[model samples]
Target: MTETPFKISIPDEKIALLRQKLELTTFPDELEDSGWEYGVPLSDVQRLVARWANGYDWKKHESQLNSELPQFTRDIDAEGHGTLSIHYVHKKSEIAAALPLLFIHGWPGSFLEARKLLPLVTKGSDNFPAFHFVAMSIPGYGFSQSPRTKGFDLAQYAEVANKLMLALGYTEYVTQGGDWGFPITCRIAQIYGGKHSKAWHTNMPIGEAPKSTTEPSLTEKEKAGLERTSWFHRFGGGYLRQQSTQPQTLGYSLSDSPAGLLAWIYEKLVNWSDSYQWEDDEVLTWLSIYWFSRGGPTASLRIYFEAGNHSLGAAFSVPEPRPTIPLGLSQFPKDILVYPKNWTREMGNVVFDADHESGGHFAAYERPEYLADDLRKMFGKGGPAFGVVSGHSGYA
Candidate 1:
């Protein structure tokens, strides 16, 4: 497999078409005083649509992304599913022995989530461990090619990630992820751990409720987390039900109308995060990626349907054998589905656990320093998974 350098270059015609679509967008009306009780407010959508049509410069943002990220694409052959051309940002640290770290993204997120994290983790320094980071656009997201066949579940996603790392000559590496990433990395650690995948970490660790007759004691924060999880299931999970059951049915709106796509994802960007202020341009750039994704915004939704159909069940509640590799969990209070410490411990060989006072689902993007610090602590000289990657100490 040949690794070819890649760049973001959306054609002028496509840009023109996007602009045209934004101009022609027909927005729906919201009920009076329905502020977020129903969905993304009409005013917010209007402001974003106006900026996207007239003010936001895709060229400038596109150029900046190209300049910042050292990207590449390679053909990875998934078992049973044929070869797929995967797009990834592979930044090797100046430290020769930097540990290789694979960062996977979930729905509504692309490799772009790793932008803030790249410099923090890969910079050579003696004070903290360094890493050779590989942030890939999971097949069917961003610039990566989507699977043609159906039933591309978590196992297939894990297979693609593992194959990409191996092809990059990372015989042994670690992983970090959240969202759908939480499950995908878990699957990777299960299938490839102890050999290619040495250790794993996640910001979103979903776990089952403790089966003890007596409920486990919960901290004030843990209690709040459960409340937040309840809130998500009650209010924020409409998209989940739709995506998991019938993604194609909703694809028409996401594919045809730029406004529909923006409102669909903009809700998550605002609600799933922990009050992280989003600039209009930043929000636009994030949304633009989905609009211009290689597999279209609809393709990204298939993981929901496929994973659910593969007996993973809704909410991925189905239990499986726990991976023995060292596992790290970084708990962000405002994350959509926050579970208690004891419940998460049941998932794997827990080595590192961090309970941050603030942040949310997009931890790497929202709190890169915290995420980076957690990894540094997990794999640093005196850390739990130190030297897990054999010769790489991740220090200068």
Candidate 2:
């Protein structure tokens, strides 16, 4: 595998085309009193579309992103999946002994999610630890190349990530992720635990309900968590069913219509978080990444299908074996599937856990400081997983 530095330079013609499409957009009618109960409000979409066409400066945000993230591309060889060109943000810490940390993003999110914590995790003080961070654009999302053939399941995503870290000399490293990231990083720990992959952390915890026969009884909080999970599956899971079962069928609309792409993702950004206020420009910038992604916006939705279905197709799930390495978790109250501490013990060798008073699905992006602090406490000098990675103590 070879790595080359990458820069964002979306062609001028693409920008012109986006403007033309925005100008010709035709909107639908909304109920007089309907707001979020129905979906993202029509007012919100109108404002965003106007800004995207006239006011939002893509070049300004594009340049800012390029300057903030030290981007790169590497061709990783995933077994049986052939060679894939991967894009990532690799920011090494000045702390010579900083630990290597791999950050992964989920659906509707890009490597841009890791932007805020890049500076926070680069140095440690007062018993807190620092790290050498590497956040990858999980293939088929962002700028990374998509899989050409089918049957690329959870294990393959893990393989690409593990190999990328090894290519960057990160034979041993810790990880942080949520959403789709939750499962992918877990796969990494299962595949490379006790050897190359060290401790892992996540904000989203998903699992089957604890049956009275096999698992322990659920507490009030755990019961509520189960209800939340159920709520997601009942109302919020329409996208999951489509993406997991027939992603290509829905891809046609997202790929052909830019407005359709915006609405498809913009809804998640609004509802998935804990009432985080989003500026129009901010929304447009995120939307732009998907609209201009390497294989188009729909490419990202297939992970749900591939992961849910077995390696062959009918059964849903690739292997999710428990890892025996030290594991840490950060519980955000408003996260989509918030689970109790006891429930997550089923994940792996549990070491440390933190419960936040606030925050939602996008913990790293919505509450970066809190997430970074939790990580420091988990791997600091007197921390449970401290010195988990050999030679990288994350100290000055």
Candidate 3:
């Protein structure tokens, strides 16, 4: 597979059409005094829509991304599925012996999730391990080509990721991800571990509930985490059910109306995060990526449906034949499903675990330093997974 240098260049016509649609937007009515309790407030969407249409500068951000990220595209042959073009960011540490890491992103998130962690993890240092990282846009997300055939479930996703890393000369590597990234990487570790994938890490570690008449005694924080998890299943899971069951029905609105897409995703960005102070531009930029996505915003939703239909159960459920490779977990309180420490041990061989007092679903973006530090600790000298990939000490 040939690798090509890629750039973020949305055609002029697409930009013009987006502006036309935004200018012709019509807003819906909101209940009096309603706030996030109902959903993304009307006021928030109005301000974001207005800014996106008029004040936001797409060209500026476009140029900034192109300049900051070392992007590339390569055709990867997924088993049972024909060759598909994959878009990814590959940044190497100054130290040639730095470890190789593959960072994966999930729904409502693009390769943009790796934007913050790139610099932090790739900077070579004597005190901490450094890494040469690759963050690929899962097929049907960001600029990557979508799968044409159906039944492209978790295994297919893992196959594509592993193939991409192998094609890049990473015969042995480690991985870190959260959200959907957690499962996809877990699949990678299971299917390609020992021989190829040496270790794995995740910010969102999901585990099955303890099956006992007596509930596992929990710390105050763990008790609060269950309450938070309960709150999510009660109120915040409408999107999950919709996307997993009937994404196409919802896709029409998301694909056609920027406003509908904004409100739909904006709700998650607000609720899923730990009260991250989102600027109007930041929210708009995140939305614009979905609006201008290559496979269209709808393709990203199909993963939920495919995984739901093909897998054991919901995305949160642990997969079969769990990986025996070293696994690290960084627990963030605000994550949608925060299980007790004991619950996660059943997921894999646990070597490193760090519970952060703050942060949320988008751990790499929300708490880059925390996530990066965890990686360094997990793979640095004296760490459990150190020297897992021979000759990659990640030191100056």
Among these predictions, the greatest lDDT belongs to 1
- Cα RMSD to native, each candidate? 1.3, 2.3, 1.2
- Candidate 3 to truth, TM: 0.98
lDDT of each: 0.91, 0.84, 0.90
lDDT of 1 by residue, 16-54 (tens): 899899999887878999899888899999999999999
Q: State model 1's lDDT.
A: 0.91
Better of 2 and 3 by TM-score: 3
Q: Encode model 3's per-residue lDDT on 1-396: one tens digit a residue.
A: 999999999988998888888888899889999888889899988888888888899989999999999999999998888999999999988889999999999768999999999999999677899999999999999999999999898889999999999999999999999988988998889899999999999998887777876867889999999899999989998887788888899999999999999999888888999989988888888888898989999999999889847332555555667789999999999999898998987788999999999998899989899999999999998999899997888887
Runs in model 3 deviating more than 4 A are 212-216, 310-314
User: Which lDDT tens digits does candidate 2 get at residues 232-283?
Assistant: 7677767877777788999998887778888888988877787898888888
Scored against the true structure, residue 30 in model 2 reaches a CA lDDT of 99
lDDT for position 58 in model 3: 92
lDDT of 3 at 108: 88
Model 1 steric clash pairs: none
Indicate whether candidate 2 or candidate 3 has the larger lDDT.
3
State every prediction's TM-score relative to the real structure.
0.98, 0.95, 0.98
Could you arrange the candidates by lDDT from highest to lowest? 1, 3, 2
